[model samples]
Target: MPYSDKIERRLHLAALVFLCLIPTFLLFARGAADVSLVLVGLLFLTRSTLRHDWAWARQIDIAVLLLALLMLVVVVAPFGEYPGKNLSRGLIWVRFVVFYAAISRWVLVDKLAIRVVCYATFAALMVGALDGVYQFITGYSLLGGQGMVANGNRLTGPLDRPNIGSYLSKLAFGVMALAFVAREQLGEKRPLAIGAGVMVPVLAVIFLSGERAASVLTLMGLVAVVIGLFISGGRARVLSIFLGAVGVAGIGLLLSSSDRIAGRVAALGAVVSDYADSIYGQLALMGWRFFTQNPLTGIGMGSFEKVCRAQQPPESLQFGCYPHPHNIYAEWLASSGLVGTVPWLAFVGIVIWAGLRLIRAGHTQTVLVALYLATLNASFFPFAATQSAFSNWPAILAWMSIGCAVAALNVFKRSCPTTA
Candidate 1:
């Protein structure tokens, strides 16, 4: 019966693995296209709940569920005029909570988990990278793809989009983790083959993703892993550092002349412009405006634009719409207000606490995963959580963090089996 349960579990998880990217893939889709991903995720959750073998929500996922409830409260709080948008935001909140939980608990829990996600990420990365390369060569996207690159050798996978960094971050972690597991299970044929098969594509895919930040992250992650290995008496310190440096440099060189990288760096100087400010700065101003107008409850979900227009400098209001604060903290305060802010902060505080605890326990891999997550959080701000709920970010990251923790804990188990 348990065997049957595990089989069923895998089946549902495999379905989730395939279905997870539907939202991102729907970028071409317009008008409530994002809602489709939400619906699909709900169905996935329903299936998971009805399964006999499945337990109640995984502990890590509870935070996301809480986020969903809080979003619902904010949406129905009667603060803003945009009921439709607020409700929709609430729906997205619930959906991401479910999506994150399903993936964390079912799809992305094991060694097979990383492989499956990697395959999907690799496909997308390859297509986008190759498309960019082709555009650079022939001067066009697959079919009239616009703004692939303006005036540099760099490439953009999808126009006006910059999410490949987060994907790359996860992939780098996945590949390194996979390599670790593969070598650990070296006597086993299956792990060996899977790891060997994935290593090349993973490298090629990250290269093509063309995310300079991600390239840096990948190097940083590998270096951390190496330092971890030697510290744990698991592998040679110099070997790890030497190899990590080589990999990071190689990726960085590939993207060095990329306009995407160059342009982003140039844009940094314009990040907080007062007059010629970027959209991000204006969004910040808008966020502050919304918070000021509705300090207690906020202007409701998705009301950033409405509230912004009402208060933004009329000249700026004449420019265009504003959706979200590019900064997650600013956005959350505007939508969720102080009431919702407490839980969000608490959740982050807990994650930091857990990570610190892991390090203190001398769980080398935990420290590695934690450090990666910390540095990544600094750079990306919420790890895909803005679009997702609080639960979703950790859900995705938990796989690597938990896997590393478990593996490291195994090392410190009651009896480190002596080679009798």
Candidate 2:
């Protein structure tokens, strides 16, 4: 290879390695994951500049730019509860955009890179799910240090918290995408068998993790995938049957296992039965109050907790001050006001449009499109309880999925009937 070509190849390989490590980092070493993200983004930019290539920026929609700009604009809001934090957060918000573009524009633009990332992510999830299963059976976790109970019997798996269900649920869609691409490239037969074999354990683990929001959002994602696949008209019936069987079996296992999961389900039922008296209801109401008071700029990123603490909820209702509103919409409204919230909602709409275009354009890429759409539906399902949009760990996962979705759409547009 020419010296310049060799240099570019090395950089691409290194970036792909880091992309694969992101899932593992999110699972265990988050600080390391942050460093890896920066490295990947920088590497991508350096290679593109050296080669005079701007393909990575081509699919970057206006909504992404608008949101990045809004983050900077919000830094100057007079109502910001923490100006220093807001300014710092605003400046670094571009990193996510950069990372996302790198994944779609260059790293995941080809079959080899897509296959590598897909397998790596699948292995990481299986390890985490198996570890969670061990903890559930033994009442101890291998990577989470000491076992602790939250909301009764929720499992933590590898993390130090009970949110592993959310973690698994969020990334499960990415795995589906990865597996589809990888399988297609390998010319694998028995697609339904492969998909069911891979996903049944993941579905079961999420159900057993005892996170109500995670479980609900996961099912919603599955529904989206099924509907998309059905409409695209390829192996939809077999896949749907496999998924239905998996769901019935998973529910039976959950019920027979113990009262551990059962108690959490009953808690969800109680919340639905009397939502106004629930803690989520109180926190959501407080978030609405923040938006109503500062309709234009809101309080600013990372300011929700500081602002929420000062205004106590009704004493008669269950409530606790949280870092961010548990809903993404509420978080945006409270933290960045209408300016931030409107742009985000529009960005989501754009994503949906892009995914639909993929479906309508060709049937060859139906499985990939289905899985990518599933990821988006689950990640941004408006009603699902969520983590802080600005938080490092979850945000990293969300952005990675978004990048993959964009990459898939780009591939569909460029090489749909043949390469896809």
Candidate 3:
């Protein structure tokens, strides 16, 4: 039932690795290549089945799964201009369901899934970084790498949007994961915290991605670690040293990179000073308008863009209507409506409960809890839903991660009967 012993349990680690890689980097999959991902998933699933790899198999999360199925049914029901687009949207939902199964059932919670995800994420970043630099040198994407996902930004790192929400999401998990690794290897190893320390520069690049919510999340995560440290009875001196060092370094970097880092310095200031009447007031009005119009089934699922596009005035000064409500809760209420919101809330509550169970069990598996929570930062502050990378993947991953976190806690409790 769990990933206990290899003899009794079969390992599909290889197949699971391919699942994350094959259909990935949608930047590479414009049209035909996109189909390859589905093929790849099938291939991996088939390979594992043939090998009798049922070690990590577990029951699917029924609530999330059914809600997902419901969403898919609505998306491709075929009442729109872009049937193909609807079909694709429908398939993305399917992919989320399939991926949830892959991660929780086959990825094998112990450590492998997180490692593969972390490696794949960093690999994507490094490749994007190189491509961005190349674009800078060549005068174009050459292969059509436009934004961060395309390779790199001209001045900052390679990212598609000005706000690197994806990078921010990734970095927050990466930092927490490193911390988990550090605490585990305390005895005979050099400080694992050193790697976490070095990661500051890479995390800085995430900020340069210009996602304001992500910046706020980063600060909040640090505060979490401080609280965690204090609650665990850590020495005050040790906590002070780490916090002080991180603070000083953070401040120094902020001051040094004021020029190339355009968003934090320019975007916020411009919004507050010259563009206040246009941005915040307009956004607030839009939020209010959405609530007033669709009080019950609040626009259909995945209809925010349709609503935003339809509602905005031609001469409005705000940015083009976004496909999502910046606030995820609003996005959910707006799109999925009350029908979708109930199941989502239930799922989230169960997940949080699972995580809390783990923290109480032991420190070892607590990393999974931290990683899931950190990634949900975007879900809380919502972004464009159409961008599968930032939205669905993390949302799906959160519930799946909880499935494993709960499993880990179970294992821990059994290993030490005292936990019961």
Candidate 4:
């Protein structure tokens, strides 16, 4: 091979390796994840610039432009309490869109890349599950630390925080998408079987991880996959119903197996019963106050705690100031108000609509696109309490899902040319 060709191949392999390591980064090394994210984007941009191959931007240009517009508004919106902070965070946020484009157009544009990423992600999740379960059973992790968080109610998995369940929830559907794609490759004889096998364990892990938001998101993602299967019209529909039952049974067994996990699940009822007095409710109400106070431009990015601490705390017994309102929509409204919220919503809508269209058009014999969309759905799931959407961890997961959806569409377009 020519020297240039070999260099290109090496760069290409590096992109794949970094892309595959994303899940591991999410699990253990967030800083590395951010670095890898930028590297992938820079690699794509470098290659595109060198070759003058800008075609990939055509599909994503609108979304990227919208993000730029939002960022510009964020930086210049004079009403914000922390203009300097918002300016920096807002500008840096555009990297996520660039990362999305790279994943879809450059890194995962083919079947081989898709398989590599899927298998890598699946393996990572398996490792996480093993680590979390081991800690739950033995009170310590293979990673050499106490594996429980929240007084042993939550499993840390491989991470040092109680976010293992949330982390796993973010990637569960993507791995299931892998299962679907694998089944398609195997002629679909065991499509539901493979999906259910993946599903039951994931569901159990999420439930046992003792994170309510994760549980809700996992169920929601599962529903999305089921819907996609039903639309495809095959034995998948029947098998989906069976899978649901098995999932429920698995959850029941998990709930019965440990009182700590079960009590945590039961606590959801208490939270709901007096939601107005719950911490989540208080935070939501507080966030709404921030939006109402600044109906156009929000207080500012990363200014939630600043603005929050300035006022009296919520009346709930669990009242405490948090970094950001523990909800995606709430955070958006509180941080950027409608000015930033509207465009962000539009981008999300576009992602969902475009992914759905791809699935409906029969681009793939698998439910990969559906599950990728599901991952996004769970990522921003409105009703579920979650971390700030703009924060590093959740933001990376969400944008990664969006990128995976776009990449999955491209893979299916190339691998399965028939459109229904």
Candidate 5:
């Protein structure tokens, strides 16, 4: 092989390794994941430049550029409380843009790279789920017991909290996408077995973690999958039956073992009744207050903790001020205000619109991409509690998925030129 060809091959291999490790790194060492992503992104950019290949730039939609510009405005607007912190976070956003561009380029150029990523994600989920189960049975995970509950009642797995469920839910979407792709590539029997095998453990872990948002989103994703299968035709009956069985079994297992799940469901009404008194409710109120007070520019990025302390009521003080409103939309409005939020909303809207269009087009690969994007949007729906959108893990995952979907759409257009 030519020297340039060999170099390109090595670069692709390195990219694949880093891509595969993203979920594992996010699970164990988030900081490391960010660093690795940065390196991979730079390498991709270098390769593209050296080869004089810039077509991938066209794959990037206007919404992403507008979002980036909006973030830059937030960084320089002098509205945030902690300029340095906001600047740091802003740099991370730029990193994600670079990461997205790089990943999209890779997906567009390499037919099988995205499949490898899906497989890697599935493997990571299985390992993480098993670790959570182990933690439940023993008093410790393979990593140790720092975050694991000793009673084996509530499984935190490897993380310091039950937040693992949210991450697991995100990965479950990837697994579902993989199963969809596998059904086309590897035939019906194998995909059915793969889907069931991967999903059951994932649902079990989500239930064991007892995170209300994660569990709800996961169930909703399952429902969406069944609907998609029904709409797409071809053995819909068998797939629906299989999915129904898995759903029933998963719910039954949770209801039998997890009092936390039952308790959360039972308390939902009471929690809603006394909305202003709850920690989440109070934080959300604070977010709305910030947005209303500074509708144009808001309090500023990374300023929520400081502002929350000053703005929160005396009763809310007992629950404590949080770094960001535990809600994605509220955090955007509170920190960046209307100026930052409009573009953010547009970005999400475009992604959803594009995903729906792809699903309507009826290609298996594009449909999987659409499903993944749909699941992601549902996971971070505005009314639900969520991690900070500007936070490292959430930001990385969100942008990465967007980039992948965009790239997949590009590939779909190329393969079916009529679609373009």
Candidate 6:
């Protein structure tokens, strides 16, 4: 190859490596993940500028601009008191856009890059799963004492919470499923077995972590895959049904083995029955109150704690002030109001529409991306108590998944032009 060709290949390889490491890095070393993302994004921008390949970079999608504008408005809106803090938070959205653009461009142009990412994510998840197992066996993780025990004995590997492990395992399941689909499509046998074997331990760790939301969402995703298999109407449908049965049995066993899991499952009804009395429920009520008070522009991003403190009923005050509403939709309305929420709702609608379009057009490769995004969405649904959507960790993961989905769709279109 010519020197220029060699240089280009090296750049693409470096970018691919960084992209692959992002999910795992976020679990253990979040600062390093951010640094890797920045470095990779800068490399992509620099290379595009040097070679006059500005087509993709210059397009600047309307969704990106709208979100950035909303963040800016949240910072400058009259309700905002901590302008400096809000400004810093707003800038993270810009970084997200840059990261998305860079990854999308790389994955779209190089068909194999997506596979690299899938394999890398699987490898990282394996490491995390192993740590969880080690923690389970010995009451401590191999990586020192980063283990967390929730509700007395529920294992939370390497992180401070069981929910994080549960979340990561679900993501790993998505990647492994993608890998299985890809290998099946390509008529590969060994990789199919490997993917299946990897998933058993991963699922075990998820159940061991004892996060109800993650467990429910994961089962839902599996159901979707089974339905999709039937819809596709192939010989694989019978096998899919068999696997689904096995998965159900495994889940039953998990629930039976763990009292915490069984108790959580049993409490689902009480949770619903007393929704209005729960701390999360009260937070949602307070969020709505804030939204109503400032329906145009919200109390401002990052101001939920202050507003909640002032407006919460004395009984609700006993729950203490939360940084933001746990639900993503409520957070948007409470912080940015309709001005921010309208665009966000539109963006979400478009994503769902696009994913359905691809699935309807028979793009199997896009299914995993769709499943991952769907799980993330379900996690942030109004009734679900979750991390702040605008926070660094969730925001980064959300944008990264979006970028990957866009790239997957683009690749699907290029490979099957008539269908897409």
Highest lDDT: give the candidate number: 2
lDDT of 3: 0.47
Q: Which run of 10 residues does model 4 get worst, by summed lDDT?
A: 186-195
lDDT for each residue of candidate 2 in 1-420, tens digit (9 for 90 to 100): 699899988999999999999989888998888888989989988998999987656443644654645654654344577778877776676678788778878888777787677777777778788888888778878877546477447888888788788878877786566556555554433432454565766777788888899988887777767666666555776767676676667777877876887888888998878776687776777788999998777788888877766666534335667888788888888877777777677778877777766665566666677778778877787776788878888888888877776775665566545432
Q: How accurate is candidate 6 locally (lDDT)?
A: 0.66
For model 1, how does the per-residue alpha-carbon lDDT over 217-336 read when each residue is reduced to its tens digit? 555555565566556644455656666687767657855856555555455444424423555556566676677777666777767767666655546553466566655677667877
For model 4 the local lDDT of residue 273 reads: 89
Task: List the RMSD of every prediction in angstroms.
Answer: 6.2, 3.0, 6.4, 3.3, 3.3, 3.2
Evaluated with TM-score, which candidate comes out highest?
2
TM-score of each: 0.69, 0.89, 0.67, 0.88, 0.86, 0.87
Supply candidate 3's per-residue lDDT for 400. 35
Error of 1 at 155 (Å): 2.6
Q: Give me the runs in candidate 3 sitting further than 4 Å from their true place.
A: 1-11, 19-62, 71-91, 110-156, 163-165, 171-198, 234-240, 256-288, 309-313, 316-320, 357-372, 381-420
The lDDT for every candidate, in the order shown, is 0.49, 0.75, 0.47, 0.73, 0.68, 0.66
lDDT of 5 by residue, 1-420 (tens): 888778777887887788778878877888888887887787787778778976756543544654645564554346676677666656556667667777756733443665567667777778788888777667577764654553434567777766767777776675455455445543434543565687667778887776667777777777776666656566764776777787788688767776766776666556667877876787788888889988887777788888776765545475777888788888888887877777767767765666576665663544465456656654457667778777788776666555655555555555556655
Q: For model 2, what is the C-alpha lDDT against the true structure? A: 0.75
Model 2 TM-score is 0.89
Better by TM-score, candidate 3 or 2: 2
lDDT of 3 by residue, 198-315 (tens): 4455455445554555555665555555545544444733774687587668756865865544545565556546533645445544554675575544555455567677766535
Per lDDT, what order, best first?
2, 4, 5, 6, 1, 3
- Which residue pairs collide, candidate 3? 147-159, 147-160, 148-158, 148-159, 148-160, 152-158, 153-158, 164-209
Show model 6 residue runs off by greater than 4 Å.
1-8, 51-54, 57-79, 144-147, 173-193, 310-316, 362-382
User: Lowest-lDDT window of 10 residues in candidate 6?
Assistant: 183-192
- Model 6, range 175-196, lDDT digits (tens) per residue? 5444544554433345446656
* Per-residue error (Å), model 4, residue 347: 0.9
Residue lDDT tens for model 4, 1-420: 887667666777888899899888888889999898888888877777777777766665446445645654544345688788878777787778778888877887655666677777766777788787788788777874765777778888778788878877777675565445545643343433544555545566687788998887787777776666666666877867776686678767877877887798779988988887888998899899999998788788888887877776544326678888798899888888777887778777776666666655653343566687777777767878887877888788767766675565556556666641
